[model samples]
Target: MEPKPASASRVEVTHLVMPGDANSLGTAFGGMVMQWTDLAAGMAAMRHARLPVVTASLDQLSFLAPVRIGHMAILVAHVTAVFATSMEVNVEVSTEDPRTGERRRCCDAYLTFVALDDAGRPTRAPPLLTESEDERRREREARVRRASRLALRTALTGA
Candidate 1:
């Protein structure tokens, strides 16, 4: 497969934080944010892999700030790295106060997705081309995170 630039698979999704998606405290629920994050990340992975993809894992989800109802939640996702059949997607979430146009960083997450072949087996994905310092940094971070996840899985499964 040809190497594709990170920008080729980048995706941005924006949504209004409705009342039903928030708690009584007026802050958006974690699950709602997670759903949006997953959707954005999945789109990026699918673009990179050019096939159906499935979520393998989610990592480094840190909710740094609260996104209140009536705010606009924005999630940006891009392919950071590709290894064998899996692609690493880095997602950043921010919230904008529509009235004032003020934005706050709310969450950061790394999602792993595996592309599937027609037979439902893992399929190799195209390599990621890091075009800038930021993309290179993300690729390096993705390697470390992948190692850590593998180590944890081995420890848990004794495999």
Candidate 2:
């Protein structure tokens, strides 16, 4: 398959934070944010591969700020790298205050997804073609993160 540019599969999603999405402290729940990030990342991966994809792992999920209820949660995701059947996706989440129209990054996450065929088996994904210096840097960093994840898995599972 021919390599595709990361921008081709980039995704941006926005959600309104309601009371149900928040905790008693009036801030959005961590799990709710994670769910949104995962969905955005999955969409990016599926768009990149043009096949069904499943989340294999989520790493480096950091919650930097609290998003209060009534804020708009914006998630932007893009493929960072592709390795055979899997792809790395980076999701950045920000919260926008409707009244002031101010936006602040609240969360960031990196996720790995595996493309699947009709038979539900892992399928090869197209290689990623980074277009800018920032994309290239993200790809290089993804490689290091993948290496670390592999090392940790091996150490824990002896596989």
TM-scores of all candidate predictions against the true structure: 0.96, 0.97
Q: Candidate 2 clashing pairs? A: none
lDDT of 2 by residue, 1-159 (tens): 999999999999999999999999999999999999999999999999999999988996778989999999999999999999999999999999999999999988999999999999999999999899998999999999999988887998998
Best by TM-score: 2
Which pairs of residues have clashing backbones in candidate 1?
none
TM-score of 2: 0.97
The weakest ten consecutive residues by lDDT in model 1 span 150-159
- The most accurate candidate by lDDT is 2
Tell me the lDDT of model 1 at 97. Answer: 97
Question: CA lDDT of each candidate?
Answer: 0.93, 0.95
Candidate 2 — number of clashing residue pairs? 0
